[model samples]
Target: MAWMSWTLPTAMFFITIAVILISMTAWQIISPCIERRGFLPLATTRGDRLFIGLLSSAFIHLAFVALTDVNIAVATALCAIWMIVLMRWG
Candidate 1:
């Protein structure tokens, strides 16, 4: 008998959800700073900042994975750092 392993798509589906969850959690933690910076909440005007944050988060995670082969935990941390930097700098 042989054991069946998880497929790549299955792993990717869970990873995608994890990334989104991490991004949303990071956004929530930064919501106050965002408001202080005069950016509207996610409910207002299509959330331009949120969109930009999400895009930057994805890129940061991908780049870290590509360069260092880090696990999801490190990738998430890097994404959070990128989000904070972008919010502060931009």
Candidate 2:
């Protein structure tokens, strides 16, 4: 896709997503998950929670970038923390 600039950061982002997906799939195969209720309103499986976490993290990053002048690292750190919390007790 020459139309799009495949910069290092962009490439790394996509690679990271691919790696996460692969790892999750392997995890599922090794140990199937049961749907469980957490702080979130509905019972959800690991994959469901992961999807929600990633989607929410996207919004979190967008909000950070749009609403503040702080470094993007702050958003990344927040997203990491939020992901851990969500995966553990969302």
Name the top lDDT candidate.
2
Worst 10 residues of 2 by lDDT: 1-10
The sequence of per-residue lDDT tens digits that candidate 2 reaches over residues 5-39 is 89999999999999999999999999999999999
Off by over 4 Å in 1: 1-46, 85-89
- Report the CA-based lDDT of candidate 2 relative to the real structure: 0.95
RMSD of each candidate relative to the true structure: 8.0, 1.4
Q: After TM-score superposition, what is the CA distance of residue 90 in candidate 1 from its true location, in Å?
A: 3.2
Measured on C-alpha atoms, candidate 1 has an lDDT of 0.66
- Quote each prediction's TM-score: 0.42, 0.95
> How many backbone collisions does model 1 have?
0
Q: What clash pairs does model 1 have? A: none
Model 1 error, position 76 (Å): 0.4
